[model samples]
Target chain A: MRSGSPVYRRGAALALLVVVLIALPSVVPAFFINFVMTQTLMLGLAAATIVFLAKYGGMVSLAQFLLFGVAGFMYGNAALEAGSRGLNLGWHPWAAVAFALAVTTAAAFLLGALASRTTGLYYLMLTLVYAVIGYFVFAQITEISGPSGITSIKRPELLAAPVSLYYTALGLSVLAYLGFRALGRTAFGLALQGMRDDPVRMASLGFNVPLHRTLAFTLGGFVAGLGGLVNVWWNGQIDPASIGIGPTLILLIIAVIGGVSYFEGAWLGAFVYVAMSTYLRDLPLIDRIGITEARFNTVIGAIVLLIMVLSPQGLAGIADRLRRRPTRPRRPAAGSADETEAAIRRAQLIDE
Target chain B: MTATRRRLPVLAAAAVAAAAAVWVLFLATDTPAGTVLDEPGAFVVTALDAVTFAGLLFVAASGFTLIFGLMRTVNMAHGSLFLLAAYVAVGVQQAMVGKTRNIDASEVGIADWLVPMLAGATAAAVVGTVIQQVFLQWNEGQELRQALITLAITVVLADQMLREFGGLAQRMVWPGAVTHFITIFGQRYATTRLFMLGVAVVIGVLLWLWLNRTRLGMVVRAGVDDRQMVRGLGINIRLVFAVVFFAGAFLAGVGGVLGASFAGAAPGTDGAWLLNSLVVVIIGGLGSIKGAAAGSLLYGTVVAFSPAYLPSQYSFYAIILTFGLLALVLAVRPYGLYGRPA
Candidate 1:
């Protein structure tokens, strides 16, 4: 969150967190990290994409999973059909990525074009209805189901190795996060901020507001779709369950828990969620914690409710507050409040 | 303007005829004309059954419409509330006659369906009030969060229900023996269906009367239009909302009992009915008393007859049809059939 501080200026706690993550492979048991890392990465990307919709385009679509589904299917079918047809187009990793992004963005464009016509809750309902429609179609379609969802969708050749695949996903996520940060400060991003602030003023300025709105959706679609693709590859197959309305809601929970304003919040949320699931699944102490594995959802739901009530600004805000808190000084007996005061002054001056 | 208005019925009649012709063509091609299709009474029987189911659907959906329309909130756990009530009613009957399943209908000996109905309604009201107070009241204006939180609750509840109730369809043993089958123009049908239909009619009419003719109804109507203003006037908005939720849930419970009586209660009914109500309320008009009625009848008729007339494999086709209808209605009247345009 305070990436600008560098190692020396970085909060000692964050440094410790980084160290823990780096050494987690050795410290934690193998299976937990494997499961946690995988799930966190998948959901993080999905929820991170949701941040773009909420912060930039001012959309809250419950049916955003439709876009995610489109991405997964595109990759799966491309891989299956191309591999069978002996075409490198499907087998090639980049090619599959391109297809996924393209299809997702295109569908985003179509949906955005329709959705952009309305505002507020109407847009949400339309998006939700469309997503449900898409989910039903995919579930019912003989082509997709085929007894089991995209069966034999073997791990691809390039990112076949789990550890290697993990790194690649992690890398992509970092890149996507950076992309979001950069775009949030750009002119196009500024225009989007304008739409969120006052669409009437933006539209009256002849800014093709609807087109920009559509592009925002397309952007959301691209990120979510990419997440879907990675998840499919990670799981070695895509099941109908992979892209249900329920999972989409879970992604929303992640976004809500992690603070939707900062892009990194998505990663943090995903990480927490996956860890929770893993802990619930494997740990016996979860029962002692008053939640059985069977009752894990209750725990997760409670946590989400608490987060929304307590710190709706999410993990990102917490990160900001921690970063702003004064660091340990060389001089003994210097209180942390002094640093916080200094930081507050700096923020005030910056605002001025 | 007067002449054009007067001719509206003529235009409507012509359109209805055209639509009927199309429906006939679709059914004729889709359904097989065998023993099941024979007996002219079969047509009458099916229509009556459809109407009965439609009435029940209307009762359930009106609750859905009222909540969503007024609050702009989607109660994803609404179906669970419905199913829980049915389960409550079942628990009552099961106490009378041991075992919740596969009992002879004649063996059920209890006085007046009213007692069980009251129990179902009361249970539903308490449960609904609790949910509203606990989860919904805090998240009043937070639409997506409310939907999702309730969804999580629904999932947890559904799993827990399945575990407790055992994944079997349990019958709500009706009071008194359904000793005789009622024949409507020589079409034999269950007495329960007729009774359920009567229940639906009474519920619908009573609700309509309550909403329109009562002071509380007037206040609720005013509150629906502008909640902030109502609160400003020192009205206990929260209490009114509790009442609305209770009434809505109680109605859903009524539908659940009636539905369970005929269709049998099983797992997954919550989701099915929830989705169906979404289509119903959205199509008719969210929050409009009349809209829920119209939407339910329209939806129920299509759902009931579609199976008899169309391919059985496409039971889900009913869902798609509802979706299409929702879109069409929203297109024509973006606020739903009776919703006030923004």
Candidate 2:
């Protein structure tokens, strides 16, 4: 993924990162492993969807949660449950998951078709309106989600335990990250970036801009669908609050704060979000200031504003700066080495 | 002249047809199994309620539209400003109570109400100006970032307001004389609504005159059309923008004060009013005074009638219906009725 001495360093970093993540459960406290990491993975997937669309499609979709919600609702409807609500079909867990994924992907494709026709602010507004409409439809229709919520979902044997569930979620997220990386190396991904830069030019170059955008949106939706599965499984219940603007905004805050320019920023942002929400409210200083959990949004909002103003590229940008720091001061390398190393450095930046 | 003359009959016929359809729908859906004229009278009550609601909404939404048209920035914090103003009104009224020991605020003189209203408006205007100067001015051309910044401001403001105001719903007490109910079609209605309606008309006329007849209004209109030209022409565009923002915020404050007198102020009022104002501006045509007025009336009427005419279970559908209408309008006319395509 890199060249020269830096290549070894990056490889070492990647290996370290992998080791840390895999051993996190055993190394960290149960609270951190069970709650923080689990949330970070799931929420990261959702945020990554935003990052994908924004980075490649140049569109900010506020309705990504609709896909998540649709999947959750489908899972709720099909999964095993008690009570006379009759909303649940009590299907096999695998079957329910499949059905939810299929429906969510299809719905996302349709929404993508409608939304991709617009650009800029109109697209943002359209997606926002759609999300609001989706919220109302899901909330008002008691038969779908039930009056209260759908609970007591049957998890498959492999995914029954919390630790196992966390691992499964982590595996899926890693697979998704790898899949996205693979996609980014493809011709379609290159064309998608070209489209984001200038749609008219891409269209002139024989790219179907709308189709490209729709495909990206669909891919993003699929990733979000996976997150929805993890989310529903973790909670063992689904409700409007899970899919509403509040949580959606939280995801947006995470994505933006982490930095949308890079895909890994999604996970980084989610980690910060989960950590802040999990830990910030209990702090003595915050408690003394009377900032209860109810007023938690204030802290998140302030952080978002600070990040937007100070570093729109977010934590990823900061990480990048730190990575590039040592290289910048070592400009006294031999002239021949500099000439040969230029292309490799450029390749490294793009690959990362 | 000939075209205008020819349009009169068509307009009249369309009006008649619309009225007939409304009457038919009202008779079919709203009439209870036992009541005859009660439902029809209730329609009048709802209509009045709608008009009053439209009046208050117009004040807030027109300001929102004005800011958007001129600056090309969607101020998400407008709702927070409205809520802030409402809280200010409530605070002012409470302070009045402390000074005069007036347990029954409705018995107080007109100055008691006027001072609070003025304070709310002034506070909102000052805050709006500060926001424009401090936060919005740097990111003038970037719409999405600016919108997010405003959202952040909104969230922060909302939290602070919630902390200070607590979760309770606070209402401004209107003068006792205007608070009295009058019988209209056997339905008791407050005279305060009539007063509010009068205020709306006066504000509308004043705004029209300001925009059309005044130098600043002319400059604002010009700026909306071409900001660069206004800047190049040696006009103080920044000052004009600041003034317009102040006026817009002042109107929101007025709306908050007026609404608090009837609807009361609560924690989520900012989000609700922001959504309502967005719908109004989107429907009415962004940046158009007449459009804001029309959109507000339609939205208000829908909100008022849906709850009254539709089954109680579907009462919440009023918001959905308004949104659906906006969607339809947007689908057909993406720029809104009066809005120009970008």
Best by TM-score: 2
Task: Report the lDDT tens digits of candidate 2 across residue range A12-51.
Answer: 8767877788898887888787799998998888888887
Backbone clashes for every candidate come to 0, 0
For candidate 2, the docking band is incorrect
Candidate 1 lDDT over A245-347, as tens digits, reads 5575677778877876667788888888887776656775656765667666667767776665555557776767677567642211011212322332343
Fnat for every candidate: 0.07, 0.33
- Candidate 2 residue A200 C-alpha distance from true site, Å: 3.6
C-alpha lDDT score of every prediction, in listed order: 0.68, 0.76
Q: What is every candidate's alpha-carbon RMSD to the true fold?
A: 8.8, 8.3
What value does the lDDT take at residue B59 in candidate 2? 90
Task: Give model 1's DockQ, 2 decimals.
Answer: 0.13
